[model samples]
Target chain A: MNKYKRYERLAAIVKIFNDNPNTLINLEYFMNLFGIAKSTASEDIDILKDVIEKFNFGKLITVPGAGGGIKYLSISNIDSYRSFVKEMCEKLKDASRIIPGGFLYTADLIYSPSVVSKIGEILSYPFQEKNIDAVVTVETKGIPIAMMCARALNVPLVIIRKDSRVTEGSFVSINYVSGSQRHIRSMSLSRRSLKKGSKVLLIDDFMKAGGTIRGMMELMEEFDAEVVGAGVMISTQKPEEKLVNNYISIFVLKNMDEEKNIIDIEISDWIMGE
Target chain B: MNKYKRYERLAAIVKIFNDNPNTLINLEYFMNLFGIAKSTASEDIDILKDVIEKFNFGKLITVPGAGGGIKYLSISNIDSYRSFVKEMCEKLKDASRIIPGGFLYTADLIYSPSVVSKIGEILSYPFQEKNIDAVVTVETKGIPIAMMCARALNVPLVIIRKDSRVTEGSFVSINYVSGSQRHIRSMSLSRRSLKKGSKVLLIDDFMKAGGTIRGMMELMEEFDAEVVGAGVMISTQKPEEKLVNNYISIFVLKNMDEEKNIIDIEISDWIMGE
Candidate 1:
């Protein structure tokens, strides 16, 4: 095998880290692959550490001792995330996006892979250090965003179905009132979806009265799982208080006038570090 | 600003390409970002090209014209993809994954980020050159796989909801038969989800008679979109005649004796280039 150059090794290392984010990798593996010694591997990692920091491409965390290795945590600077949210707010402000039921049409934004992946990265950043075992969401709209968040955090995604399906085997179902609609709805999750006492982060595409997320939290109780954090793409400002506390929303919908065809949305104060 | 070393620039390029796969990024953008000359950027690309090929990460294509730039197309070697599918088959052959009513419980595998992302990459590889405008899938199980496929193809994801909802504004709904259960069901897509005359790739997690995928194909007709291709993670073998044709399935379920607790699954022959 031909020996690889430092730049070539560096390029390959970046790609590997990018491919498997939040995954622990042993230096010996790279040492063997690149035919390099421990000293060279350490130097390459040091250079990569500086490069990631300079570009705000997240962090490369190294642990010492046995059963220890390096892992990549994908986090972006506040400004870039803020700018992305601002662009989303601008797109959402379009009056044409309003539906008949006073709801904003956000499917376009949430469904786009490029857009939602960034949303996922931003939403999952805060909970990266929370030791989350899984990311949870309800069926339908939240699945994409939640999936991306799960991908970013390097965790499994557990989706709670709106209605019980026969295909999922044994499941746990619960009925909760839809906060905005005021109708009791049932949600279900397979018994095998989570292990007991697994720490999870909840994610959703949109939130209004916080009923859905609260329902998810309650559903977590059935599995004896803990909800470490909750995140939504957008939440209305009318309900200053939500059913659950300590949740994050990327955008706050302050007002949407149906007749006037106007919408006032902004990046959430929490995201802006206010 | 401090001058970046050649290796540092190579590392940054790999990270950028990984972040925005299939995106046409201009060389001027890199030059501006790194304060490097055109010749230096060319040398870096040459090195990255060699590194990516050696690592089997993917391809970095450079277009040489005013409207042309460089884009990353994520494609793995056939052996790697075949091995991934083989591993999936091994996990799936476990009798415990069988559920009542003869359905396989695949939520855990389909919902996994790492596993599903690879499935997405493999599924989207063939369609990459087709200029697919979006990846389409029905809601629930297929969303994660479809979303990752869209990510890999660098296109938007359009999810067809099983039931029409008020939040999506105007939508076109269609009723179709579920091939496996032979039950009539309705699927809907928002009017604004796809542009007219766009080319789309249909993806799903599993198919028996392929009724759901056929339903998606019919729904695509309403928007005047062409179905360029279709892919599924797994398809049953007994249904030799499927509702849809010209689709790719990564795995073929040869037999599943529910009473005997046996599942014989294998990587699809096409993937192995049989």
Candidate 2:
């Protein structure tokens, strides 16, 4: 192939790895797809690694020997995380977003593919070192973010539904007292959705009193799966007593004065190195 | 600042555009972020377009004059679509996927990020030219694929829930006869989820009688929205009389012989240029 064609192949390989992050792609697959030799494929990957490093994009790991190939890890640097949180905090500060009962309207932001995918990258970073079999979340608002995290981690997303459906066959449902309202709420997972002894990372959109995450943990226990970690996009400051501990959050909602139409928010101290 | 740094910047630019497909990104933002001159930013986009074209990755459009910048279109070549469909059909043919009701268990495949996202790309390609304001789908199984198409189209995903919740404020519910069993089923969308007079693209996981898509179209009519197009990942061939027409599907399920433990499936003829 000519020099330009080689450049095209390099670009294509980068996209394939990016699309399937954390998944191994054998060198032979690429060589056969592009009609190139093993050495040429290796050279292309080397160029990709150099560019990714200089840009601080992410890590490209090359497993040696048999049963190994190239894998892309979607880990963003601390600066990138800080910038993302800061920008999101600014967007959330809009007075109009404060609906009745002080709940910030964030459906638009969470559904935006670019924003949610970036949030997923930041939230998935700390848990990447752990052996996660699936990324789990409750139904409705958290699906997009959890889906992105699952994509980044190269794992399946298991959604815990508020109500079980006939289409899902048999499901295991559990009820727990919500931390905020102290009301009994139930969450269920399809019996076949998760495997016993598998490790799961729990994710959510907001963490007020950690009621939902706590409920999800209990549900995971019923499946005999280990809760490896939990993360949320935002957590309110007033909820001093959280139902769950050791959860990571990107932003902290300090206060929301509905009467005065003012909201106080900041990027989480975790990203600030505080 | 340097040659290597320029290469890194190019890679980052490509990723940013790829992540936020079909959204206009102003050049000034790039210039300020990279601390580069206007000419340098323009030159970087030129290089990206060249690489993308050689690989047939997608198109990078540059708008001129005021309110102009650059945008990326994530349209993969037809060959990529065929390969994706071919591989997924093989995965679906496993005998174990057949459930008690003869319904194929595809929750795992639909939730797999890499596979779903590729399906999203292929499905979103035809609707990219339309004036689509939102990508809509019914709850649970269709969320992941619909989210991907919404991402590709750079629109918010408005999910129609099977049941209403107080958390969503007000909702508009509708009942329709599901084509497969001719059973009356109801679906609802949050009142605030969609805007009046907006264009929508409908997406789903499976189509047995096209009842669900037709129901969605009726629901969209209530919201004063337009249904520009509909697409599904799989559709059964036995449903000779579909409830709706003019929809795209990636795969066709020819037959499922439960007694003989055999399955017949193929990539849709639409993808084969038939």
Candidate 3:
């Protein structure tokens, strides 16, 4: 091989690792492949892992076992939700993620797999101890964590859509506050989709004012189903103000918008390690 | 005992099994917990497996040894990508999911660990053979798959926001056709994100006119980065129309639009055993 370029060597290393998802690779092989030292191969993978993570493909697990190698497990963070919310609180301390309408787009907070997994563990904590009829959540973002929690608890999910489609069959309507300042709002879910009297674990993406959860509660009532428990990806408000209590998820920092529409941010109770 | 509900017993069973992660539950204890015949306890678990799988929860596997009762692992159907995608395609076939826009707003599709896992598998395919410096994807819906894929490929994701935010430093601009047949549209990524000459693998939620991939390609050019591969969760147009040829992911359906507005769904060429 007339001197291989940096790109060629990088490609060769990736190919070797890709052939085995969880298999280990040694520096000896890469050194032979690229005629480079172990330091170069190590440097290349380090740079590559950083770039790939930014793409959201996954994280690289570097193992130092007897047969050490890189193992990839699609994890968010270890107990991602917990650590993520913790990270969010720090971001909140910067007070930037605040969206208009007094809501925090801690959607990034939802992205942490470790946090998501931990929250899944927490929400499922109660349900895993019960025979859950099904997991219920509104359409859209909440589906991810809801699905995870529901899976952990071993339940079916009944996702309530905001707009009922023709195929969904007869619809039931419910009223509750939605988006910004808890304005009264209404949405629809097909009655045919939910089984009557089935226990439902209500879920949503976020609860700033807690209106959507209240709305889902009403939707559950319309279907004559019981609200067994509720889980959310994040909650930036107080639990007492809402109809539900002690329902769990992650919380970064809480901030309030005051005069001139300025906001101050701080971490919520969950990520304080409580 | 005052007779706990089926959920109560199921929860107990799950807790006992899960506390061990992969431990087996004995039949003698099953008979004691439900106070029912060994056959009845066995039947209940069989039903629960179907229910749990829907949530991407682990399965209640049976072992045939004297100590075997039910062995539960934390593994969801999503533990592997190929099988998970197959499961979602089966769910999409339901007539109830058909809707307007030729778009499938599969909230379940997004959350199903198995589905996402399969999506991860498909997206990671091309990049597996190549050294990927990063995983790049637009935000909102595509985040999960991007995140999961990043997780699998041991990479970090750099998000391309639809609108530029305050934190984004320096920027690269690009344009492409939109799914709605809209003429060349622009999307941006933070300049601080991708380094020069880094190899990027683009991913997105759905592919229609292939504008997003095209846009990403243009962005890669702007950054002087090499485009390794591109993947879509669902490709709605004819494969030939895909601007990026070196790609792999699912082929949802051909076209569901104007003139015809008919729906035709196909599993990704990969999951189809291609």
- The number of the candidate with the highest DockQ is 1
Better of 1 and 2 by TM-score: 1
The residue-by-residue lDDT of candidate 1 on B1-274, one tens digit each, is 4388888888889998988888899889888889988888888888888889888888989888999888898885566677788788899999998887888888889899999999999999888888999999998899999999999988999988899763677889999999878899999887888899999999999989999999999999999999998999999997899998879999899999998999999888878888
Ordered by lDDT, highest first, the candidates read 1, 2, 3
DockQ-based CAPRI category assigned to the predicted complex of candidate 1: high
Q: Which one wins by lDDT: 1 or 3?
A: 1
Q: Which ten residues in a row have the lowest lDDT in candidate 1 chain A?
A: A76-85
Model 2: per-residue lDDT, tens digit, A37-126?
879888878988887776677888888989999898877566756777787889999887776765777877888787888889988998
lDDT of 1 by residue, A126-219 (tens): 8888889999999889999999999989999999999987367888988999988899999999888899999999999889899999999999
What's the ranking of the predictions by TM-score, best on top?
A: 1, 2, 3
lDDT of 3 by residue, B1-274 (tens): 4254454455445434533433456778877756777777876677666655644554567778776676654444333455656666666666555555444656556544545654665567556536677778875467667766654454556677664442343566666677457776677775656778988888887776677777778878988989888888777656456666766657566545434534556776545556
Give me the displacement of residue A268 in model 3, in angstroms: 7.8
Error of 2 at A237 (Å): 2.7
Q: What C-alpha lDDT values do all the predictions have?
A: 0.88, 0.84, 0.60
TM-score of the first chain in candidate 1 relative to the native first chain? 0.97
Cα error, candidate 1, residue A61 (Å):
0.8
**Tens digit per residue, CA lDDT, model 2, B1-274:** 6344555666677767777899989889888878888898888788889888766778888888799888888885666567768778899898777766777888788888988898898889888868699999887788899999999999988888776552555679999998888989998886777899999999999999999999999999999998888999898998788988879888888899888887788888768877
- lDDT against true structure, model 3: 0.60
- Residue A205 local lDDT, model 2: 92
